[model samples]
Target: MAAPDELFCWEGAWGLPSVSSDCLTVLAYAQFAGAPLKLRKISNPWRSPSGSLPALRTNQNETLSRPADIIIHLRKQKFNADYDLSAREGADSLAFISLLEERLKPALIYNSWVDSKNYVEVTRRWYAEHLPFPLNFLLPGRMQRQQLETLRLLRGEESLEGGEELEKELYREASDCMNLLSQRLGARKFFFRDSPSSLDAYVFAYLAPLLKAKLPNGKLQQHLKSLENLSSFCSNILLLYFPHDARESSGGQKSSSPPQPEGGDYDHVPNKRRKQLMSVLVALGAMLSYAVLTGILSIQHMQKEALEAPPPDRQTLDPLDEDEEGDG
Candidate 1:
């Protein structure tokens, strides 16, 4: 278990999915306002079929096979039934995924090959200047080589002439997708609804990687910087979930007096850790009270019936119970 308010992972350099998932965890903590939850960031050596990275495990003895499984597990812990997704919200999440597949994926495919005269030149120049030497060497060259091999296999040398046309198609698709996203975000504090939703988390994750990419002449950088609200939202969530000590170390200042323990004896040191632990305990007590009041964690017979009901088949694991009957 993590100490209160201690973040298990670092942020900023992480990929889209990881960042978005972290944000979801932060949101869960914020909603509870309870004891800080442990964040176990695993760096799994295995890769998924989609070529994505796998999660690291916190407990050496325990395993969570997939991201969805992790989400379900989190849902079972101190779950707020009020946070359950409605039918419409579920459909919207699916729609967001579909849109990304239709738009972003095609653009990625096309951009790999022939560079776009319109956007490609600008992006290429940017990448050349800002991207790290290793990445620049790997990404563009690999993409171009794959494109050449694909062209050769599909159309022979004759089809090479139409590469520019394919590139143009890709640019069109990507631009269209970006425009749609911008329009959807117009005037609204969030993308999916009034408050941030699961869909928003996914969108933020996918876009964060693109936003973090080195841009030419800092054009893309400037664009992202201008989105103050979005940036603030991201930063606020980070700080809340990943609180850190900010006190400055005093190397120059001399100690006025020797540090003394209570009762004239070297004893317990009063420090931030002790203070944080107390705060966490208090928060936990408050949460238990609220849960009891709301019937969210009630022990009433009828409420127990609902809580004890077997989770739907979609969930492979059984809910943890106070007794052995709940164990899977």
Candidate 2:
């Protein structure tokens, strides 16, 4: 038997299997397809083979970073969840997925990273606490910037001056998308019938975080809760395929580990040691850079202040010299 492909994804928090939507998407798709995957839940992306979350390391030793590419690879390996879908259903799935990316994604990003209250109180705090020390200081801010850029690109704007107007627009579009999805799902156990498919995976991933996370400004979450079907849909997926995650999210302790990969626990010791070494080296480097930068800025600021200061009073010194002459 071949070793299961290894999936490197963000660590679960706030009760989801992973905090990242992209990671959740791939994880759900893999589960739906029955792909044998060794899950490595991590806070630091640098530990992953591709230096990114949601990376898949195949049996052939190839690394795939994108969720779409990982799904395609799984399908090629004969683990396709979408294989049972009819042509029309497949088309509908594609259309709905596209709609999700355009309409729902920006608001998700905004709620997670751009919305000040949620970002500060929830999103940033979660990452900062979970991530390794120096990375805790860096990656959350970097991730926020990337999400903001993604929002700008999605809106086809040079920049997004996020305010009430922008938030209103994003929330409105997302709410409408959720309503449409609720109408389409309409009590169906899964999106495409009894069995889950790629669309179910995408929908579950996109909605689960919003449903599960405790955002400070929860306008979209409020709207989602009002649409009971959509809320139930996310809950059903959690209870069905991800019971462990559901339990953890609902405040229960994790009683057991997810299934392990082919190797024995001892086999990973060397790799674990290596990752620790790398983390230490990276932390040291980051600290060194910060120190050097701080010192340089301090020196420059002092130089500027010195140049701006008035010359010392020579007249006062002359008075002291005359007093010495008079005493002589």
Candidate 3:
């Protein structure tokens, strides 16, 4: 067969470590589309849209500089009417995009909180900052630091505190997403109603990092092992597109064993529980403040009425009677 059409050619880092999951999802979709994908290394990791390096160039001669924009462009192209993209397939793609946006937001907020800086500073610190030692050379180390730092900031701790909570939340959300996919997929091998669609690629891409993540505790690892299909999809994609790296990473292990999926009583909580809790707390605080203000207002109103009411008419009759008696 002739070489498949190349859809995405990325340079340097397509997505920052904070959102690499999304980056992987993008790649998975491209690969699933039977599009040849390649990554060209750049001397500077911090190259921005205005920078000289071209991050993405499609077969159509279109160039995209940002990861978000790149995904958007891909969706529009792949799902275009002329492309005959299926409705169900398009919905999956949209869902992937939505999940990615949700995942990236907190990371952005965490970066801002740590640096108290604008988007540029946060993005630069995340993608371009140099790390110490051998870790500086490894992609995982570079990516890990940014992720850890963001998590630290989010937890408001000096170190990677609250990662448990963060990880839990991530797992919950991802599981919910995956669960939806599982239902749709049922016994089918792919996400598309009939055949494997671009959605599978996106889902796999976003999930790769999680599959590769070296969790300190067995929690996340165990959680991942539970999603058999997701695990299978990730492993299959890694083998196909990144065989050498996958081999080296897998260490010649022949077993079809998936990583032990993390499990706990905590994982089953609603995915957005933390967000909901925060909203409830905010509402409660606002209501309390309003109640206090109303109480103060009521007291002030009563005091004003007491002060303004005409003084009871003074009894002047006694003085008049005294004067009349004196006259008599």
Q: Give the top-scoring candidate (TM-score).
A: 2
Order candidates by lDDT, high to low.
Answer: 2, 3, 1
Better of 2 and 3 by lDDT: 2
List clash counts for every candidate, in order.
3, 1, 13
Best by lDDT: 2
15-63: candidate 1 lDDT, tens digit per residue: 2213223333333333333433454432221222222223323333344
lDDT of 3 by residue, 257-319 (tens): 253243342333333677578679989999999998989867766776788653344246666
Q: Which clashing pairs does model 1 show?
A: 42-56, 43-56, 126-216
Between prediction 1 and prediction 2, the one with superior lDDT is 2
Model 2 weakest lDDT span, ten residues long: 253-262
Q: lDDT by residue for model 2 over 156-209, one digit each (tens)? A: 864687588899999999999999999999978898878999999999999999
lDDT agreement with native, every candidate: 0.45, 0.88, 0.51
At residue 175, give the lDDT of candidate 1. Answer: 60
- Misplaced by over 4 Å in model 3 are 1-19, 36-38, 42-44, 47-54, 57-63, 72-84, 103-170, 193-195, 251-328
Name the 10 consecutive residues with the lowest summed lDDT in model 3. Answer: 9-18
